[model samples]
Target: MNAISIKGLSVSYDRKTVLTNVYMDMEAGKLYGVLGPNGAGKSTLFKAILGLISSNTGQVLINGEPVEEQRKKMVYIPQKGEIDWQFPATVMDVVLMGRYPFKGIFQRLSQEDKNIALQALEDMGIANLRSRQIGELSGGQQQRVFIARALCQQADIFLLDEPFVGVDITTEKKIIEILKQLTDKGKTILVIHHDLSKVKDYFDKVILLNQWLVAYGDTEVTFTEENINRAYRGQLSILHRTTLD
Candidate 1:
């Protein structure tokens, strides 16, 4: 069965439609790139999939079950720019939050949970910054901290929104490597990416969107000039021709 399925999904704000009649079935163990021009409802799509917002007319299922029933199996990393770096938390504290799903509301984090959080930081190559305040870290370091937190969740599906933005090239490479390792272990990863130059190298499958589903499938086949034109209204036609040449 597909790891995630969306059917007739729609969302609206102030009676104006933001997303419409979206349909897709995302398979397991692959890296998917969600692409679109600005205002294409990319973030809205992620929100709908996670059930963070009410969909106007459809459902999202994971492993044949509603998303709420399988919440623990998924982890979402929002764009760094959306966060407040001034939050009074340490790197370790942020990572430990991932274990909250395993602990009830009143339960304190156990030593084992601390251990997992440390391991996650180590895996991300930021163990040395465990005690540092989150706001003190550099942009790349901050992104690593978030990814480490997600790793501590040990989730089957990872949805990262524009993770590479403002990060250094080395950090981007490291993140991609970690994602590939996750897919090798049968995990599903979806990334909201805007860098068209790297799309061919980073994703095996790509979903192109512009307030709706434009195309989705193998990166090589679905990421074509014609489909990109339809989604971008021919604005990126030259880019498509140049990139695909």
Candidate 2:
């Protein structure tokens, strides 16, 4: 079954139509890339899929169930700057927060939870950053920390928003590797990537959107010049191409 399915999805902010009728079916166990220029409603689409916002005219289904009730299986990573790392928290504390769903609101972390969080950091190659204050890291390091937090969630699906925006090359490579490993194990990944150059190597599927659904399908067969022209008005689409070597 597909990991996510959206039909006739639309969203408006203060009466301005930010997203128009959009339809998409995202499969499980593959890395899908969301490509578009700024103001393309990429984040809004993410929010809708997570039920963080209500869709105006459609339903969002996860594994054939409503997203709201099935959120337990999905992990979402917002853009890095959205969080104020200066809020006085250690890396461990932040990553461990992903374990909250498995615990009562006021419950303390279990030994198992701690182990999961640590394992996530280690798998992400940032175990050394566990003891540092969150705000003390570079942009790339900060991005990895959030990805680690998502990993700690232990969900079957991951949705990362602009994770590589300001990260360093080395950290980006690590993040991509981690994503590849997870999907290899049958995990679903939907990532919002701003760099249009690396989409080819990073994602198996592509959803080119611009406040509306322009294209959605396999990367090689779907990212044609005609479809991109409709989405970006014919300007060379940012095809963030990369390959794992």
lDDT of each: 0.89, 0.83
lDDT of 2 by residue, 142-196 (tens): 7777778878987878889888877778878777887888889899998988665
Best model per TM-score: 1
| Predicted candidate 1 versus true structure: per-residue lDDT over 1-245, tens digit per residue | 99899999998988888899999999999999999998888989888878799636898998789988988888899998888889899999899989999998899999999999999999889999999999999888888888888889988888899999989898798788888887898989999998888888899899999999999999999988788878888667565568765
Q: What lDDT, from 0 to 1, does candidate 2 have?
A: 0.83
- Candidate 1: list runs displaced more than 4 Å: 237-241
TM-scores for every predicted model = 0.95, 0.90
Model 2 steric clash pairs: 196-238, 196-239, 196-240, 197-239, 197-240, 197-241, 198-240, 198-241, 199-240
What's model 1's overall lDDT? 0.89
